[model samples]
Target chain A: MTRLTRAEAKARTRERLLDAAARVFAQKGLAGASVDEIAEAAGYSIGAVYSNFGGKEQLFVELLQERANDRVNRAAEIIAEAEPAEANGALGRLLVEVADKDADFAPLQAEFWLYAVRNPELMETYAERMREPRRLLTDLVARSVPDAERAGELSSIVIALFQGLVRMRRVDPDSVPDELFGRALRWLFTGAEADEEQP
Target chain B: MTRLTRAEAKARTRERLLDAAARVFAQKGLAGASVDEIAEAAGYSIGAVYSNFGGKEQLFVELLQERANDRVNRAAEIIAEAEPAEANGALGRLLVEVADKDADFAPLQAEFWLYAVRNPELMETYAERMREPRRLLTDLVARSVPDAERAGELSSIVIALFQGLVRMRRVDPDSVPDELFGRALRWLFTGAEADEEQP
Candidate 1:
């Protein structure tokens, strides 16, 4: 095994701690999870967690921000790859596909939001953390849908549907086929007249 | 206080236990919560919990079912109260209003869903519980929307948006206005032509 410098060791510890926190948070939830468990899961001591994250809440905030950025970046890439005309459809397909592949993501997100709501301080940070993603979503919706001004509303609707479907899919996968989200996006962009035309 | 009959006393204990379970589950989450803590919160013995619920998992299932029924029944009542002509708008308004009024319900629902996903044995029952609400929502959408066959898809979309908004609202209330949901419903029924005219 290659030996690591102090800086490299610190970075490695932080990354491992974050990865462990994600798994533990998803499995046990935010409010109910313990930091010692996170440290152990990372094969580190409690002191490592403290030196790296200060505490569990801070760790969670960093995790959430990292995740939010990943989602927005990945979505932007999907939209970028598609032609302007197909960007909206591509966006819808990407959202559904990501949710299908990342089963842990939804529960971890749900736990984060649940913890955020119960703790006002966390909610403020979370709300701020969410701004960029919403802005990106709004811009994409504006470019796709005919009514540009109401893009924010459309974005919210799409996001809300995405989150709701993710929750439903967790308990009832059969009821929430990925095609369902695609149909909703079509309806949003092209109207109900078009939604019925699809199989 | 008036003395209670045996049946009335038993009912009161069960009710208190369920209420306590909701609070405990919300505060500590399902997996982390213990039957002893729920019993203590309800001012009963662990024996009472076992007598009423068989175990923690059973209690959680009962709580989830109760909450789902409460949401559907309340929504049905709201739709029922509205005139047929105004039903769609009224339905959207009602969903938002109910969500705002019962903030705890969303987090609790999220927690329950996370738990359900982790526990495969519970998913079947949870899905079964969800079908009635979805059916009711589909029927309501069919009556209000232009296309009868597409109503189920529309219903799924609306429900997904509602759940997603609830999750988002918990973190960032400012970004996700309750009116957004109302407008989505209006757009679904009347299309973008109607959306542009709304304030």
Candidate 2:
């Protein structure tokens, strides 16, 4: 049998538990998933699940935090790699590709949001976690746009547009074409220029 | 009891069933809700539900169709009433207001979307229904923008932005402000102007 240090074993167990939680939650939904099922899926005992993470809710929150951070980091990398002029197009393409590829993530996210909204305390904490990512995206937008004045609001729109489009695409792929994103970005840029010229 | 034609009685029963469905689906979700509960809530027998709609799936689809039509019509009215110059701003304000005022609508819409994505057959038909509203909005955008070339694409963005912002508001109200919608519209117009001036 493979041997490991005490702390290393504990960390490995936690990782397994989280992986199982995400899969179970995605397949069965937050309410539908149970601690026992997650533990079984993780190949651990019920006691191990409790010892590793206090409960299912904590496990879920951790997963969301990890995902949020991972997404922002990945976005930063994409933005960093793209030429300044092509940054928006690259990001738009990236967002669409991510949304298309991850069938589990979006539904899981929507389910989590629904669950969090019903619990005021959870919602508050989750909302706080969201701020860091939103701030990062806002700063990124300000840098990308020709007019930095409206960057904050425009960034929010871009984020919202990506989310809403992905959601529609999920339900009906034919309606939301990949090229529409580029066109929309161009249109928004044109609008921003007009606004800047106004006396 | 007042005398009524057979068709009128059937219509009344169908309406009541739909009303009950909206309430139940919002509260309990598609999977969580049962046909018996919907019928009981409607104050009709199970047979009335089956006779009127054939099944829960049909009932849900009808509800979606009704909502989709209602939203497009309302949007058209909002656009029609606004002066040409103020159309985009007016639409932005209206979307925000509608999202803020109707708590039930957004959740119900999300739930319906979640339900549709899981069922491929339903998604195809639902997606088809979506195109009409998108076309209507696209035509509206073509008329609103100073530059009509990118209007169709811009319209999709506007729709996605509205949906995404409302969703964020539902989960975390502080992050998505009411005024942000106007600011976004303004930014897009400015960007468009800048594009036009570019050599």
Candidate 3:
């Protein structure tokens, strides 16, 4: 067995706890999930949860930060790798693919959002975490759409459209086809003329 | 006061129970709320709730149906009253206005959506209720956007954008301004050129 430094062991434990916390939060919701349950799921004691995260609320906040970072990184990579003309389509397709694969995560995200909204004290932190991803999308819009007026506003619409599709798909998956994301993105960037050209 | 007929009394009781259920469920969430609390909040007995809604789940489904109907009716009225050129902007403004006024209700809607998504059996009925509003938007898009290829798809995008904006506003109200909806709607229907024309 390889020996591990204390820092490495602590990092491993934190990762396990976050993974378990995601599953528990998704299954039982943020308000319903308890520290003890999360700790047990992570194969740790209650003290460990408190030591690492202080409480369930902080744990959730950290988890959200981690997820947001992952999303921003993935989206940045997609934009960087794709040709300038194809970046928006590639990003839209990636979002759709992630939405399909991470279907369970949507509810979890919604749950935490509600939790933060209901508790005003957490809203600032939640909003702060969201800024990075929103900025990234704004940059992408500016880069991809020529003469894109109010690129920030356009980016907000794009974000909302994606979030709304995820919610709609949850209730009626058949209604929100995989192609819808790419199609909608094209329309938003290029407009009705582009859509009319399609068969 | 005039004595009420049995049917009238039952109808009144059902309405009160539903109103109370919305309040309690919004405050406590679906899983955390109970039939007894709802009945107590409405000054009704547990039997009254059971007789009216069968259970908490049924009460929630009915609440969602009522809300969906109310949205569709409001949207229809806005479209009916506005000049053809102004209908989309009016509708978008109404959505933004509602999101501001009914901010608390957003969390409640999200909670029930999460509840429905987590339970498969409830999803079909939930989707069925959603179809009316979706169809209304589709019709509006087809009528308003000349040469609108795939109006159904465009309508879906609009719905998603509205839904997403509501979610975003809950966490970061400042980031998603009221005018953004109308601007985004115009761009979606007309394309980037329309946005660039705006001062």
- Winner on lDDT between 2 and 3 is 3
Better of 1 and 3 by TM-score: 3
- DockQ metric for all predictions: 0.46, 0.50, 0.50
Q: Any runs in candidate 1 off by more than 4 Å, and if so which?
A: A1-3, A31-37, A45-47, A144-148, A191-199, B1-3, B31-37, B40-47, B144-149, B191-199
Candidate 3 chain B, which ten residues in sequence have the lowest lDDT sum?
A: B190-199
lDDT of candidate 3 at residue A133, scale 0 to 100: 77
Q: What is the TM-score (0 to 1) of candidate 2? A: 0.83
Candidate 3 CAPRI grade = medium
Error of 1 at A180 (Å): 1.9
Deviating ranges (above 4 Å) for candidate 3: A34-37, A45-51, A145-149, A192-199, B34-36, B45-51, B65-69, B145-149, B192-199
Q: After superposition, how far is residue A32 of candidate 1 from its true place, in Å?
A: 4.8
lDDT of candidate 1 at residue B11, scale 0 to 100: 95
Cα-based TM-score, every candidate: 0.86, 0.83, 0.86
Worst 10 residues of 2 chain B by lDDT: B190-199
Q: Chain A in model 2: its TM-score? A: 0.87
Write one digit per residue (lDDT tens) for candidate 1, span B124-189.
877787777777877776665556656777766677777777667666777677567766665565
lDDT of each model, Cα atoms only?
0.74, 0.73, 0.76
C-alpha DockQ for predicted model 1: 0.46
Positional deviation of residue A78's Cα in model 3 after best superposition, in angstroms: 2.0
